[model samples]
Target: MPDTPTPLIWLAGATGLVGRALLTELGHEQPVLALLRRPDPSLPAQQQQQQQTALVDYAQPASFAALPAPSQVFIALGSTIAQAGSQAAFRAVDFDAVLTVARAARQAGARRCAVVSALGADPRSSVFYNRVKGEAEAALVALGFERLVIARPSLLDGERASLGQPARRGEQWALRLMRPIAGLIPAAWRPIRPERVARAMRLALAQEWAAVQVLESAELQTVGD
Candidate 1:
């Protein structure tokens, strides 16, 4: 057990858009242990000093045995169909990989998790992306974390240029059209900044509720604000 200081937070997807923002929100207040599939030498010295990384193969459960216990876990792992190159590839990252990390962490004594899910996620949905996200959510919930925060954000806007990551053109177009008429749209359907979603996830981290808590896009709008 940690003394005086807060327990470590195990963060996955620490290189992604929302993950980057969350790293800032947690700052130095909460110690973090980042789980990565591989080492990143390009990381700045500050990040290197602040957080320790544990490399674990996502496809193999045995690799997770190396992970230390964490009080909080954030599962931000995701991939687009375009980025993944195929439906199978996309599902492998968004669904299978996410659950693998969550299960391993659960077994390692992580009692809480904040998962980044899509706005329209539903296990019974016809849309493949939403369905996969929903399934991941359901699976994680079944693991019975003390507190599980489900953050459902719409189009995530961020400076992806820094990471050499591809922009989702479809989401960009939707955001452009919606920005002008944003007030006309429902709060849950509006575009959200990656930072906002990060803030929401951080808020979830602070809660000690013993039930599943869902932060919809509309609620996320206010939580981050």
Candidate 2:
């Protein structure tokens, strides 16, 4: 690998809220290769011309060949089991897709892999969501990357496209009530901006750390703050 000041990065889920925020934070700092599930002509217009976009069908492992070799890989991949409508579909995106990318990055000689996970991710949890996240974290840990960072955030403070939904409304209300008393809340349970998470992810790759660092919400907020 070239001993360049800024390393090349491969970013998955570049269209998601956090992913897009990461791209913004990464702008002009390093060369970025953004991967999307399908070719979107509009994406080029939305992103800086210097950034490279690759169309990949993550469901098909063979499509990974379309991606360029990168020094680091950032995964912001996620899915709600509710939206997936099935447990299997949820795991497919949250776990399977990430593993595929991790394997590809390892093969491409990436120095590090950083991913955004959620809070309460325990593979042993009876709750399906946390179980999947925990399983994914375990899988990534086993990959033995030279540097691996997993960010687990709580009650992400971000806007949903659909604001009228009951869940969004409830979340907004809870955040409003908590924002005033955020200092009183435990570090692990405070709400954090998605942008903060994105910034932390970028820093994880840019900075040096001990092997297999798991960034709890407290650590993530500290970096983001």
**Pairs that collide, model 2:** none
With candidate 1 superimposed using the best TM-score fit, by how many Å does residue 144's alpha carbon deviate from the native?
A: 0.7
Model 1, residue pairs in steric clash: none
For 128-171, candidate 1 gives per-residue lDDT tens digits of 99999999999989999888999999878666667656787877
Q: For model 2, give the 10-residue run with minimal summed lDDT.
A: 160-169
Work out candidate 1's RMSD over C-alphas: 2.2
All candidates: CA RMSD in angstroms? Answer: 2.2, 3.3
Q: How many residue pairs clash in each candidate?
A: 0, 0
- For candidate 1, what is the TM-score? 0.90
lDDT of 2 at 93: 96
Kindly report the root-mean-square deviation of model 2 from the true structure over all alpha carbons. 3.3
For model 1, the run of ten residues with the poorest summed lDDT: 40-49
Q: What is the lDDT for 32 in model 2? A: 90
